[model samples]
Target: MSKEAIVARIEKKPLSMTINGKKIGPIDVPVGMPMIDFLHHYLNLTGTHFGCGEGVCHACTVVEVKSDGSMVDTRTCIANAHSFDGKTIITIEGQAKTDASGNVTQLTPIQTAFIEKFSFQCGYCTSGFIAGATAFIDRLKREPVKRADLETAIEEALNDHICRCTGYVRYYEAVRDVALATPGCVIGQEDKR
Candidate 1:
């Protein structure tokens, strides 16, 4: 069966949104433009990445902050700029805490764990991993996972992302370590060991 169908092209217009807490746009942007391009070319946020144009690779994942302050991972490659018209997003650039003068004060614990565990190789997938980990950890706060199920939970969170360098064990260990070390973050039965 032929799957070709013609859809009317939407007119391009200016796009403006708050990115990493900064106002951007009122600048011209076309409708249907991939957000990865906008972030890289328009905003110079190369950290969001562009591994596969398709969302399957998971390397271009970004966190979308909802109106209620909850977050979810979104694939920028499959999403358009207008999809984020009134939304807040956290990219790799915004992962660290800033000091009074705007200098980076500290890295998020996940990033720190990655550094401690050496969780990346070429680092193309680091941003995606970090974004996913952030989402996962945030979820644990609301709905904690069992101790025995911790590995599975971490796997489910990060298994989709493709890493050409690391075989993923290190990444898994890093996320798990953070969860375990964070103190009362993930709810579970007491360890019997």
Candidate 2:
């Protein structure tokens, strides 16, 4: 890659954020680059993967606020940086916990679930699946999800991602585990198959 040109100078603007539990800054960043590039190149938050630059792959998924109060997985690879100007964005880096005693702790329940289920092989697609699964679990938390609904949610969430390794069955299992672990959210109906 080339430095190209400093077409623009990023200002020291305020960007208040509370990632995980810590309040991250009010930092300055280039205004035009995509959020994924900024996160990887600038912030060094590389866990967010990129498969398709055209936004078809959920490999670059990150949680963001929708027009409504709910949160949805948005493709960071294609999302503009300035669009997140004031909103709180959560990347894979923001999903884990940090100890007050100065030690980084174990992975969150969602992360642990992925590992326990052996959700991925190459690991390229793991983070995005984690992000999407987090949202899916959150959605299930609010209501009683049926078997079909659980499958539907998993299908919709995983549809945008292309995993060349570890066929999607494991990913589905991860989501299923999270859903089943959450009370009242398990696939309740009989297997139609």
What digit string (tens of lDDT, one per residue) describes model 1 on residues 24-99?
Answer: 7777777889989889988889999898899987899988778878778888998898778867899999889897
Candidate 1 ranges with C-alpha deviation above 4 Å: 1-10, 100-102, 189-193
Clashes of each: 0, 1
Per-candidate TM equals 0.87, 0.80
Report how far off residue 27 is in candidate 2 (Å). 3.2
CA-lDDT, candidates in order: 0.85, 0.73
Instruction: Write one digit per residue (lDDT tens) for candidate 2, span 75-178.
Output: 88788776676576688877887677746697777888778878789988788888887777776766657876777778876777778895698788777776
Model 1: which residue pairs collide? none
Worst 10 residues of 2 by lDDT: 1-10
Say which candidate scores most in TM-score: 1
In Å, residue 86's CA in model 1 sits off its true spot by 0.4
